[model samples]
Target: MLDSPLSARLEASERILVAGAGGGFDVYAGLPLALALRDQGKEVHLANLSFSRLESLDIDAWLDEDVAVIGPDTASRDWYFPERALARWLDAQGLPATVYAFPKVGVRPLRAAYARLIGRLGVDTIVLVDGGTDILMRGDEAGLGTPVEDMASLAAVHGLDLREKIVACLGFGVDAYHGVNHVQVLENLAALERDGAYLGAFSLSRATKPGALYLDAVAHARSEMPDYPSIVNGSIAAAVRGEFGDVRFTARTRGSELFINPLMALYFAVDLDGLARRSLYLERIEDTVLARQVAAVIAAYRDEIRPRPPKAFPH
Candidate 1:
């Protein structure tokens, strides 16, 4: 039952890689979909552009120069290793706990890492899951939020040859704190729709099995890393559980007011190639070998363009 365009597109794929585009807890955004795919008897794998200190990992953990296989017992000194946290959670659930992680490198090395993973995993489809909508920012927005990791993942996957490439983003308005304008996100989606890139959106309800599992996974992660739980996933999980306005799931968002609405539970997906084509500065970062180089390129590009003024949603 291909209920949505995203599912329909993925229907033919046997091996799929759902990767975290913006690193950190971004891969958690793909959990529901990955679980649902597994339920449908498809082989789904998890990976992330890791924000952890990969340099501390043992040499045997390295699957490639920039890529490593994170497991439940992967030794790490970093307290905020989301990949290892997720691996532990998966292991507890008696699921495959091996998560492929890439160091925070630039597009060149990142792309090479992705290529190695795709080839080794025999992945026919790649879904880049972003925890927030910041990945949709096409370079000229008034605020780009955190575009470095997102754009790097986009550019890296854009260079890959695969049967299908998709981008799925959860946590719609959560990027407000980072200065992302939801109006601009909508405007960008409209543009993608015009380009035939928008795959439409869907909601994750707590009533469903995948949603229930997602909540459990998030709760486990929170318990494991109590000091540094993901604010983004916490907000989304709150929304999924029918919480509203300033829902306080974690102390991380203490000083800030959160608009925890049902919309945060919605997943907005698009064609990866279409998104890559839409990013005005994606090409400039293609040859980058270091994360800082990608940041510098984006900074220089932002300096040249007169950004579109941020607009409020006039409802």
Candidate 2:
């Protein structure tokens, strides 16, 4: 029996795809949920919008024109391949090591690539995961905080036909470094709730098996790429361990002060299509073929609207 609406929505789903909506270490944000679901005997697959240079990969790695299959042993010219690093870590744990990677493209081609993958995998449910809450930002926010990749993924997946489409975000306040306002994030979530789209929140604890494995995976990834450790996941792992107030897990956040509170460990979910429809400019980037084009459209949209001034949380 599923207690939360998020779990209830996914209760009937047997084959689930947990894909990173934002590129880079965003897929790591979905690891705990994927691991927990897999432990329940559900078939879960992992994928990411890769920041790596997919063109440098061999032809055999290509699952489609835009999708690449990255395994533990997949060769790559770039040293910073998050997908490959994650695959290697999963392999070490005796789990599935193949992670599907989609090149950073605009919505049209990205949606087509997703369609092909969905058909091939026989996926009935898709949970698009974002490392931070910035994916919840609407166009009228004071700052969008690097929304190109996240929006593209949302727009693409929202168009797909599936039994369930969900959006989940971890590392709540981490996007402040990227100029996001947490007050707005909360306000947007309130709006989503009013629309019957918001799913209740839940926390991950180090006491759980999935949480322990997630900590191990993040530590392993940090050791693999010390120079480029994921600040978001590191903060999240810290929160799960009951840490608080400016916890520094890596040198990447050495200069910036962090707030590693319990909120950072919580996962907030919403209906994907509801979130997409609330985005004022999603339609503007629908025809974009390149990532830069989506950025340009968002920039233009921002210029045309007077952004709501950011507010601080009232105690």
Candidate 3:
């Protein structure tokens, strides 16, 4: 089962819902996973913040064939559909679904609606993607930068404690504004206590092929590369053991900077792997050390914010 492909994970879930910010990234990542679930006879729902100005597009044509080429308007950046619309659509469906959110998702009412979805599902897992991790770490554009506080609020509203929750941290991609990157933040994971609930991190490593690497080739062409970060396989192997113990915390093992929606799908894929190993539950409280680490980083950033002395002392 360790060598089983993503299809296996999708097949295992009775019902699945893929959610993320709409964009090329999501189409590339999340859509494939949702289609995989559908292929396996599992009820699947795909939801995202809209980014198309086409009013509405045909979903069937987009996923007509394996690795199909979707039209431009299906995920154009100019469009910004509200999350509430997706939530309403899901509520109407009346089926089990997992809502995934990415970094800097500030649509408050959408999140609230998702919390209600948790109650509706009763027994379901909520996967917070790498982008959401960014929001959790740096707070939002409004300067409300407390992840612990936010999680606490969500827990209270949902009547669930995070420490007991299966919180899977998708630990790849170097995109600072949306993904976890700072070394200090990564180091602090050692202190986190998800109670007995599983808290795991994953990072992909570059592949060893017979030719120049893809990232190197892109760099030579001066083309933009995706934000996903890479590490030595040994390092990832070690971190996996350290964080998850005997449990396997799966990573793509393919070096790719993932876009928003796909990143959410990857979160579910890995979470499914962990779930297969052992059942993970939500605890009322996570480790207090998370608070200490947050304070330390905030203080470090605060120091950076300190006013500097005048170039020359005043007379």
Query: Against the unseen true structure, what C-alpha lDDT does each candidate score?
Result: 0.94, 0.94, 0.31
- Pick out the ten consecutive residues of candidate 3 with the lowest summed lDDT: 64-73
- Better structure of 1 and 3 per TM-score: 1
The C-alpha stretches of model 3 lying farther than 4 A from their native spots are 1-13, 21-41, 49-108, 115-123, 131-171, 177-181, 199-315
Model 3 per-residue lDDT tens digits across residues 1-315: 444433333334564545433222231223223443455675655434323342233444232211111232234233333232232333434432222222222223334444544444442433332222322232211222234333422332234322122223332322333323433233223323232222433222233220112223222212121232222211222332333222221253344432222222123223322322221111222222233443444444445543222132134
**How well does candidate 3 match the true structure in TM-score terms?**
0.36
Candidate number with the higher lDDT (1 or 3): 1
Q: List the candidates' TM-scores in order.
A: 0.98, 0.98, 0.36
lDDT of 1 by residue, 209-266 (tens): 9999999999989998999899999999999999999888888887999999999999
Return whichever of 2 and 3 wins on TM-score.
2
Q: What TM-score would you give candidate 2 relative to the actual structure?
A: 0.98
Worst 10 residues of 1 by lDDT: 1-10
Clashing pairs in 2: none
lDDT of 2 by residue, 47-74 (tens): 9999999999999999887989999999
